[model samples]
Target: MKKAVAVILLAFALTGCGEPKIDGSSEQAFQTSMQKVRDSLAEDKRAAFNDAIQVIAFSQVSMKELMQAGSGDEGGRALIDKKIKGALAGKTGEEVIDYAHKIKQERAANQ
Candidate 1:
């Protein structure tokens, strides 16, 4: 009985330790979301939106940090969040994705 219980516990632990799924569904969803946001943005805001995306792409700050800062709603974090929100306003997901693609192509060409 002891050996059976040990094996069952080990099996459960091993199952939890398996590698996470790497399917691109999450990436696709992200692109879709970006496109939607970009599409909603005003034409005048598109430049700011692109600049904001570039900042995110090039900055050392992690997305989690940015999200946390935005949510904090105090001090410099609030200011940062406001600026980012302003830039992103009225943008669509498609434009975001396209901008990312453009950045990728530019990087590739430079390399």
Candidate 2:
């Protein structure tokens, strides 16, 4: 009886000494939380980038139209830059498309 009890206690002690079981559910939960954080950050970055692109696109299209219309005149280039720079100054690359359309409209009207 004493040997049996000692063996049982030893087994329990050995089990307790080993690493805890963080099973599949806990790991899954951790992974899910991490992924959510990453996804949220990615979305925010994408939005900022889109905004920058919108600004740049507006400037590019505007400059292109103005330059084409003016036949490469320096005055036209300056005018285009003056009109579009303010709008595009703080934008990210992905957000420049919006401004490009606006610039296109302005250039068309000026021509």
Candidate 3:
């Protein structure tokens, strides 16, 4: 689940700037759209979403680099975008965040 979130985050970060060849939305619009998605999520999910955003915000990764990685690589980027969207389809934000938290708790217990 962590891996899934990481992938989604990476993909989202990569695709956020709106690849000219792959995405039609502008960067501002893409951010707005993502915010809307987060807003639509339930409270718990919103918290998790906020946490994820914070992580991304604090990370040293350069969004410009991420965007460059996605550009000129339509196939990989498009596939990841599609898969992440499909995997998240119909899932409530709360459920996704709860699952992630559950996994974290179990991992901590095991350790």
Cα lDDT for residue 70, model 3? Answer: 67
* TM-score of candidate 1 to 2 decimals: 0.33
The residue-level lDDT of candidate 3 at 111 comes to 100
Q: Candidate 2 residues 7-98, lDDT tens each?
A: 99999989766422212234354345333433434565645444544555355555466666479677776655554454444333333444
lDDT of 1 by residue, 11-100 (tens): 999986642221223445545655555555679865765565875454334566677766764654645544544443444544444555
Please give, for residues 1-111, the per-residue lDDT of candidate 3 as tens digits. 999999999998987554121121444554555566677766666667666444423232355544754686666555444444433343344544554556567758999
Give the CA lDDT, 0 to 100, for residue 52 in model 1.
53
Question: Which runs in model 2 stand beyond 4 Å of their true positions?
Answer: 1-70, 90-111
Maximum-TM-score candidate = 3
Which ranking of candidates, highest TM-score first?
3, 1, 2
**Which has the higher TM-score value, candidate number 1 or candidate number 2?**
1
Candidate 1 or 3, higher lDDT?
1
Per-model C-alpha lDDT, please? 0.55, 0.51, 0.52
* Comparison by TM-score, 2 against 3, better one: 3
